[model samples]
Target: MKAWFARDYGRPDVLRLEEVAKPVPKPGEILVKVHATTVNSGDRRIRACDLPPGMKTLGRLALGWSRPRQPVLGTELSGVVEAVGQGVTRFSPGEAVYAFPGGRMGAHAEYVLLKETGPVAHLPEGVDMQTGAALCFGGTTALTFLRRGAVRAGQSMLVLGGAGAVGSAMVQLGKLAGAHVAATTSAGNLDLVRAHGADTVIDYQKTDIARLAERFEVIADTVEAMDFATAQKLLTPNGRYLAIAGTLKEMLGSLRKGPEGKRMIAGPADERIEDIVELGRLAALGQYRPHIDKIYAFTDMPAAHAHVDTGRKRGSVVVQVAQ
Candidate 1:
C-alpha cells in the first residue's frame, strides 16, 4: 500500500508518498479499499504544526514533539469494504462505506482499517465517494456547535468564513434548523455561500463586520477572525458564541461566563457514530451535500495540501485514493 507520510512538521512539501505494509483488519474491524479521501484544515494544521497563539506547546505535546506520531496524515475516507474481521456482522465485504477516523489519521492511503462500531457508516446511495469523503469533518463540527448553542427556528445566526468546509456546513445546518442564516466570505464566494442556504451574505474583505448594525442570536466563527469582545457586540442578549477555531486564550474563556447570560462554546467536537449516520441520511435525502473544491490524484496529495493551505477553498479538497 502507498501512503503519504509526514515525518516532520513544516510545509506541504514535507509529505512524501512511500510504500508501506497494508494493514489487516483486527477483531471487530473492517479493512476498506479507500476510493477517496480529503485534505482538510485539520490535515494542514497537523502537517505544518500550525497551532493558534498560546497553543504551540500544548499542540506539540498532543501531536508530537519533533515529528508526527502518526506519519499518515488524513482524517476521513470513503471506500469499499474489502474484508471484515471476526464478529463484525454490522458490515460485510463489498459494502460501500465512509469512515471518519477523526484525529486518528491514516486515510491518505490505498487501504484503511476501521472498527465496526467506530464513526463509520454505509455511504448512502446516490452519494459519490468524493462527497462521502468530504462529509464527516465539517458536518460533525457544525452539528456539534449548533447543538451546543441550542439554535432554533426564527432566530438569526451568523457564520463567519462561510465558504470553507466547516463554515459552509454551519450555514446549511443553521438554515435547516430554521434560523435566519447570514454568512461572511470573500466577494467571490457570496453566491457560493448563498447557495449553501445563507439568507444574507456579506463580503468580509469589503465590509467591516464590527460596524454591522444587525445582531444575531447565535454567531459561529469558523475562521477565528472575530474575538470575544467583537462578537459580543454582534450577538443579541443571551446569545451564544461558537468558537470553532478559537485560539487557546479564547478557548479557555469558555469557562468564564459572558455578560448578560451570553456564553462561549469551545474545545474539540465530540465525534459520534450517530452523527455520521445522520449525515448519510441527509445526503441521501438531498438535504445535505458537501461542496468539493478540487479533486487530486492520490499521488498529488502534496498539491492538495498546498491548495488547502491557501485558505481559499470553498469547501472540501478531495483526493481519489483508488478507482
Candidate 2:
C-alpha cells in the first residue's frame, strides 16, 4: 500500500508519498480500497498546523507537541469494501461505500479501515466515487450546522465565504430547506455562488457588510473573515449566528450573549452516521450535488494539497486514488 504522509507540519511540500504496509480490518471494521478522497479545509489546516486565534498551543497539543500524531491527512473517502472483518455484516466485499473517518483520519492512501457501524455508508448507484468523496466533508458540515441553526423555510439566510466547499454546501442546503439564501464572495466567484443556489450574492470587495440590504434569520460565517460585533446588526431578532470558525474570544462572547439577544452558535460539525446516510440518499435522488473544483491523480496528492492551501477553491478538490 502507498500513502501520502506529512513528514512534518509546514507546507504542502511536507507531504510525501511512501510505500507502507496495508491495513486489515479489525473485528467490527471493514477494509476499504480507497477509490477517491478529498483535500478539505480540515486537511489543509492540519498539514499547515493552522490554528484559530488563542488556540495555537492547544491545537499543537491535540495534533502533536512537535509534529502530527497522524501522518495521513484525509478526513473522508469514497471506496470499495475490499473485505469485511469478523462480526461485520453491514457491508460486503465489492460494495461501494463512502466514509468520514472524522478524528481518525487515515484516508490519504490506497486503503483504510472503517467500523461497519461508524460514519460509513454504501454509495448510491447513481453517485460516482468522486462525487461521493466530495460530498462527505462539506455536505456533512453544512447539514450539521444548518440543523443546529434550526433553519426553516421562507426565512432568510446569509453565508459568508460562500464559494468554498462548506459555504457552497450551505448555499445549496439553505435553498433546499426553502430559505432565501444570500451569500458573500469575491467578484470572481459571485457567479459560482449563484450557481449553487444563493438567491443574492454580495461582492465582499465592493460591498460593505454593514450596508447589506436585508437582515438574516441565519448567518453562517464559514471562513471567519467577518466581525460578528458589526454583523450582529444584520441579524433579525431571534436569529442565530453560526460561527463556523470561532476564536477563543468569540467563543467566550458566544457564551455570554444576553438572554434576549440573538444567539451565537459555535462548534465543530458532528459527522454522524445518519447524516452521511441522508446525504447519500439526497445524492442518489439528485437533490444534493457535489461540485468538484478540480480533480488530481493519486500521485499528485501534493499538488492537490497546494491547490487547497490557496483558499480560493469554489468547491471540493478531489483526489482520484484508483481508477
Candidate 3:
C-alpha cells in the first residue's frame, strides 16, 4: 500500500509518499480500499503544528512530543470494504462506505482499517465517492455546533469563513433548518456560499464584519478569525457563539464564563455514525452537497497539502486515492 507519511511536523514538504505495509483489519474492524479522501484544515494544522497560543505544550502532548504520534495525516474518507475482521457482522467485503477516522487519523492512504462501530456508514445511492469523502469534516462539525446553538427556523445565523469546509456546511445546514443565513468570505467565494444557501453574503476583505448592523441568533466562527469579544457583540440577546476554530485563550475563557447570554462554545466536532448516515441520506436526496475545490491524484498528496496550506480553497480539497 502507498501512504503519505508525515516525517515530522513542518510544512507540506514533510509529507513524503512511500510504499508502506497495508493495514489489516483487527477483530471488529473492517479494512477499506480508499477511493477518496480530503485535506482539511485540521490536517494542515496538525501537519504544520499550527497550535493556538498557550497550547503548544498541550498540543505537543496530545499529538506528539517531537513528532506526530500518528504519522498518517487524513481524517475523512470514502472507500469500499475489502475485508472485515471476525465478529464484524455489520459490513461485508464489498460494501461501499465513507467514514470519519476522527482522532485516529489514518485515512491518507490506499488502505485504512476501522472498527465497524466507528463513524462509518454506507454511501447512500446517488452519492458519489468524491462527495462522500468531503462530507464528514464539514457536515459533522457544522451539525454539532448548530445543534449546540439550538438554531431554529425564523432565526438569523451568521457563518464566518463560509467558503471553507466547515463554513460551507454551516451555510447549507443553517438553510435546511429554515434560518436566515448570513456568511462572510473572500469576494471570490460569495457566489459559492450563496449557492450553498446563504441568504446574505459579505466579503470580509472589503467590509468589516464587526460594523454590520444586523445581529444573529447564532454566530459560528468556522475559521477562528473572530475573537469571542467581537462575536459576542454581534450576537443577539440569548444567542450563542459557536467557535469551531477557536484559540486557546477563547477556549480557556469559555470554561470560565460558561454558556450564558451571548455565551462562548468551543470544542471539536463529535464523529458519530448516526450523523454520517443522516448526511449521506441528505446528499442522496440533493438536500446537501459538498462544494469541491480541487481533486488531486493519490500520488500528488504533497501538492494537495500545499494547496490546503494556501488557505484559499472554495470548499473541500479532495484527493482521489483509488478508482
Q: Which candidate ranks first by TM-score, i.e. highest?
A: 1
lDDT of 1 by residue, 1-323 (tens): 99999999989889999998988889999999999999999999999998888999999999999999998988999999999999999999999999999999889999999999988999989999999999999999999999989999999999999999999999988999999999999989999899999999999999999889998999999998888888899989999999999878877898987898788989898798898899999988888898999999998999999999999998999999888
lDDT of 3 at 8: 96
Clashes of each: 0, 0, 0
Q: After superposition, how far is residue 65 of candidate 3 from its true place, in Å?
A: 1.2
Residue runs of model 1 more than 4 Å from their true location after superposition: none
C-alpha TM-score for every candidate: 0.99, 0.97, 0.97
lDDT of 2: 0.89
Predictions: Cα RMSD each: 0.8, 1.2, 1.5
Cα TM-score of candidate 1 = 0.99
Ranking by lDDT: 1, 3, 2
Task: Give the range where candidate 1 is weakest over 10 consecutive residues by summed lDDT.
Answer: 246-255
What Cα-based lDDT does every candidate model obtain?
0.92, 0.89, 0.90
Score candidate 3 by TM-score against the native.
0.97
Please, what are the lDDT tens digits per residue for candidate 3 over residues 42-148? 99989999888788999999999888999998999999999999899999998999999977998998999988998899998889999999988999998898888
Distance (Å) between predicted and true CA of 63, model 2? 0.7
lDDT of 2 at 49: 92
